[model samples]
Target: MVEAVSRNSFKAYDIRGKVPLELNSTVAYRLGRAYTELFQAKKVAVGRDVRHSSPELVKALTEGLLDGGCDVIDIGLCGTEQIYFATFHWQLDGGIMITASHNPQGYNGMKLVRANARPISGDSGLRELEERVVTSAFAEPVGAHRGNVQVCEVMPDYVQHLLSYVDIAAMRPLKVVVNAGNGCAGPVIDALERYLPFSFVKIHHEPDGEFPNGIPNPLLPENRDATAQAVRKHGADVGIAWDGDFDRCFLFDENGDFIEGYYLVGFLAQAFLGRFPGAKIVHDPRLTLNTIEITRQLGGVPVQSKTGHAFIKERMRLEDAIYGGEMSAHHYFRDFAYCDSGMIPWLLVLDIMSREGKTLSELVQERIDRYPCSGEINRRVSSPQVVLESVEKAYAPGGQIDRTDGISVEYANWRFNLRMSNTEPLIRLNVETRGDRKLLQRKTEELLVIIDGFA
Candidate 1:
């Protein structure tokens, strides 16, 4: 007989659930056996974030790994990117990171990576692990080959790796502020500033599992004000913040205005293309026009990909894209094994601003004006598919429609992507126009009505 596993625990890219109930020692033990059997990995590196429940879960996971005849190197209390770093740096057969990644306090999850930092998702290897956990068919080890857990600190070397990507000597002296939101980013940012030519004002720079300033998610409007306020109050040239695990970063202009990730995509796209001319750049389908226009203007190929990191990274590797980005702030680099980094994007942005003698806002303003967007609006509904179907049915007769990731309806003047959230029961709508805010607003409203009508 198979042990029951909660279906809700299997998310789009990872296994995320509330602690103890959905993800506990039993689940970890089963996952360890499944991972070892699936990858045949003899050695694995593990890292965790600064969450209260993380230590206990890490112990449970390590025990399972040992039981499965694998050696585990526990790089204690690090970011998701650091786990990726450890996998490649230490030549481990696989790596796992215990992080909810900007989710609330009670939430905890795992990010698995194959050798060379290759991600393991549901379609790839995660589903197999899930099956093993559900079936409880893990084999017990017979011999005395139990895995040993060793503590290792890789932050210093990881910081050096980050600095290698940017020319710190050429970086002009500038005032910057970083809000880590009391997450794992504080230590990395602290080490990075020590080697840079800029002065930094750090806020919420301590690692507090309590999340005193709410969750570290910068996507929420409420979470951004503090970073913006710090930038303006300190007369800083730029402001940057990261989510809990620091996988995605948010930027603010000198005047404390939050810069949209779409514009940053163009900015970084132009920078990477300038270095590797004619290289392919991949972007999500949500903000196609901006990336398309920028990549064309910069003499590079712009390829549209479906949202989600798994899709973006796979597409990047397939197209040999030098870089990939989404409007939701996930940025992936081919140089980093097509992995998304919350640290690399800001470093490149700062380098661009420093080298060009352009303000952060000035660098991205033209692109923003060229492509005005409605951002992303979420609407709750019982049936997300029904809502998306309704929106598609409403617009399909009059416009060009594509269901690449979601339903994208396009006309000559404007376009919109109405897709259902993979993790939540909601429809995400993003509308953009050539240069008209009014048209964007109108279409956004119409799309909202179509979506709500289904409810």
Candidate 2:
């Protein structure tokens, strides 16, 4: 009998868990072989983030892939998007990124994609992949016919593609503070610096697997202070910070005020609609008024998709949307294989600031005032489903209900979305009002009361 491999890391979207016990090199090696056999992938590209365990995991993963007669192009030490870029840009068979992506230091994970950079999630292929790995179902390696590994550099070409999104010559020189959070974005920023005309004030900019400053998640209130302070200290036009794998980026205004990601969705949609008139823009269900209103005002279609990268990308492909954004800071581009990029959003924001001769705050303030939101608040509970149904039962009668990804009830002046977390026993809540801060506060508390009652 084969010893069982832990399946704890196999999430709905990707594989992520604590290292050694949950996701060791043994598990990675088996996954590689199983992935090769399942997809019959001939040419695969693999990349890793700035995590200590990543290198070892990549080695074992590559060995298994090679054993299964798959040629491996190792794009060493890169953000998650770089693997996506390599897969689609080079027209390779598949790609795997070894990154836990803003998870704590002792954790690591992998994000897989097939040709054209299409996501491979639980409903897609990850479940089948998990079964194979668990059962040790893989063909024996024929040593004589094993494939080879090649180390390839993708930065120069990647930088060129990033610059193609905006007119560099039209951009004005502005002071910008960039916090890499000791992740993989620093190198990409360095590569793009020579081509752009901005003075960058770098903080924790170096890529360190140790994550000396912290785990690099800017979504947490405490993790945002560094970037905000830098922006104020330098009097920069805007401040940008990215997570461990540099997949989702967060922004801060000139006064060190953190700009909510919901507003940025509308901000980016407006930018794209300005250039590509009547284009379709995809947004998540968490927050919608600002994005929908802005998209409509600009004569662009706003398509709402369920939250998560796979769903958003699929929706974008179905709609052929010009852009897709989740309030969580994941921005997807049609040209970039409908894949999210932490780098692209900032570049576009800067371009908008440059051309309009406006500060980052000025560009997004109108939308913020129009849609005051209670940013995603999470509460631990005994039964998340019970709480969701309770909230829905209470509010569904009087409001317009949307059950796309979660329970969203919209009234005349206020709207709220209450959804259960995919990985935790927590219910995530988001409330927004039509320019009413007081209403936003009251409803948020009211919903919390209902949630706390269940607790």
Candidate 3:
């Protein structure tokens, strides 16, 4: 039986835990068998990130898939999205990427998806996989029917697919800064270089499993300074940095100013709507005044989706939205099989700058001036639910309240979304003001006081 402690790794979306203790070869092997049996998958694509334990995890996972009587397509060391692309592109039944993805070097885990690059979440298949992994649900297969393993490198086609999103000929020769954060993004960037004209200033580009510099989580303010400094030193047009597995990207302007991911929703929606008029756009409920107003101004419908990828993707297909953006740096495109790509957002920003004859700052500066935000503040408390209720009671009377994904309270000039994280024991908050940075700061401080009192 799989250890009861191992189930801690099975989160609302994917698997993640410390290596050799909560997750290891045995857990991966059982997960592989469970995924195969749950989907009755005939063929599965697999890939891995730069984590030290990834190779061993992939090996054991593949063995389990083979023993489950499934054919395996190993796509070699790659980012999480590579497996997503291969699963849909090669018409495989499912896929898994061995990655801890922005976690510390001591951790390792898996990201799984069904055919067509659709996610398998806790409600969908992850819960079942967890139970099976613990119970060893499926019996062993015969040797003759064991699956065969094949290796296929699919980066060429993936690059072409990314480039197809823009008019490459119209792209200007601009100095670009790419901070891979020493994850799996370097190889993909090198592959993409052959097709593009931009000169890249690479930092932390090499894939080192040890992560000597630091864990490659760009969302942390501490992790962002290096990229911002690189942008300033080189006088580049823009700087882009990705997390460990390169699924989400953060951007900085020419002046080394970090652009809030919330503002990008409006900017990208405007860019896409200019071409596909009246197309729908999906946004999370965390911060909405800027997005809703921008979509309306651009003559596009705005749909609010739950804060997770699986929820957003499902909602996108239902609404036929052209794009979706979360404040956490996840940008989903309709053309990219309704999947989020760290690579696509920067490329689109480059295209926007080129086509409009503007710098990255010029493109998003106005949005910043119009709606300044308190970029996702996280606080650990004794009781998250009680804190949430306290904050809601304090402000819900004067503001319009939304409980879509979290408790979002909207007032005339300012708004905030306060909720507990799905995977962590903490209360997360995001506050924004309509062209009033002072108001944003004051409200955020006031809310923090009420929340801290509960804790």
Candidate 4:
């Protein structure tokens, strides 16, 4: 079934494709052999999300790993970060997670990491692995090798690791709505609830691959209403929603308001900077001013990196950054092997609110107002590169331009970033200004007009 599978399954960041067609047991098996051979790995950790196809993929992959003389530590039914945790926390040679992560059901994927949970993306060994998986002659069948496979539970240790981030002694009682969206997050939330003091109103808490309420991507407008409504319905202090694999989480304020990830990056930057004065913090180039301004306000250094987890993590390590945040809700902590963690972000926010006795909105509202931003807007175009070029040319007369990750043109009061998608024929635009929401809106519209005309 996997012989004719599309190479599109091998993405820029990870391997993701629709089940049984583009991705299946045979493909997973081939990938396993290739990964083990490429890394020359002897011992590795394997984890799987709650997708129905995950079990077969996991088994097939493990079989191939075993055939390649690699012993597998299977942390069964885990989120992407759990495998990351196991690989780093246990000092294993490598790890792979079977998950599509917020994609629609019937879609499945894998995320790979080397020791210390360092990401293995396209530019960093994924391409080589892709070639190996296709061209190399993989080894013998499932039971043909002598390598060992062990089933282990790392939840207790993982929860303990999460608890290590904060003191937790001064934490206040806060009613929070946790919407797991029927993914792997439910179990982690349940585990944390037993140790933490907050009252949780759990919604869609099952680890169901059927995904009765639809895929768990909270970034989608349709998916967010449930979490917002739950926050309102429960009269909770905040709402938390996660994707299918729970690597990224979204937040909602007490008034059923969805908090944009961009603002949260600034908020977390401040929190970390306050604690570790003059610490380095890394942010993506898509939206810059708020993060840069806030980090500087507290005598901390703000470094901008190209977008994507692998790139961000690499930069954070290079600078010894205390934290890194993508405006897309993926937060990384220095204490967490410089890898991204969705669970730690919400926990840190709660700790911050409890310490300050301020609402979630109160902590971020000022920053959001000062730098009102046009949250990312994606427009499909026939020639996304042409549209980007046209926008760059139009804005070139006045604003300073940067090609860090995309086309970012800046003025004193307002700026906008236009980046074409790596996997799709779409240009994503983000506009922002200094306390000028109207300017943000107007600039966004002006760019859209240019983009539309080009289209």
Off by over 4 Å in 3: 1-5
List of clashing residue pairs for candidate 2: none
lDDT of 2 by residue, 30-124 (tens): 99998999999999999999899999999999998999899999999999999999999999999999999899979999999999999999999
Which of 1 and 2 is ahead in lDDT?
2
What are the TM-scores, per candidate, against the unseen true structure? 0.97, 0.99, 0.98, 0.98
In terms of lDDT, the poorest run of 10 residues in model 3 is 1-10
How many clashes would you count in candidate 2?
0
Error of 3 at 24 (Å): 0.8
Say which prediction, candidate 1 or candidate 3, comes out ahead on TM-score. 3
1-455 in candidate 4: lDDT tens per residue?
23453676999999999988888888898888898889988889999998899999999999888888899999999898899999989999999999999887788999999989899998999999888776776655466455799999999999999998766888999999998889999999989988898999999998999998888998888889998988888899999999988889999999989999999898899888878999999999888899999899899999999999999999999999999999988899888889889899999899999999999989888888999988889899999888988888889888898898889999989988889898899889888999997887888888899998855
| Winner of 2 and 4 under lDDT | 2
Per-residue CA lDDT of model 1 for 1-455, tens digit only, reads 66776656777799898887888767777788888888988999999998888888888888888888999988998899999888988889989998888877688889999998888997888887887778866666766878788888888878887887788888999999999999999989877877899899999999999988888998988889999999999999999999989999999999999998988888889889888999999998886888888899878999988888889989998999999999999999887878989999999989988999999988888878888999888888899977877777678998988888888888998998888888888888899999998898888888787777766
lDDT of 2 at 160: 96
Extract clashing residue pairs from model 4: none
- Assess each prediction's global lDDT (C-alpha) against the native: 0.87, 0.93, 0.89, 0.90
Provide the lDDT at 430 for model 1.
Answer: 90
Residue 218 Cα positional deviation in candidate 1, in Å, after optimal superposition: 0.8
RMSD in angstroms, candidate 1? 1.3
User: What lDDT would candidate 3 get against the real structure?
Assistant: 0.89
Indicate the residue-level lDDT of 290 in model 1: 83
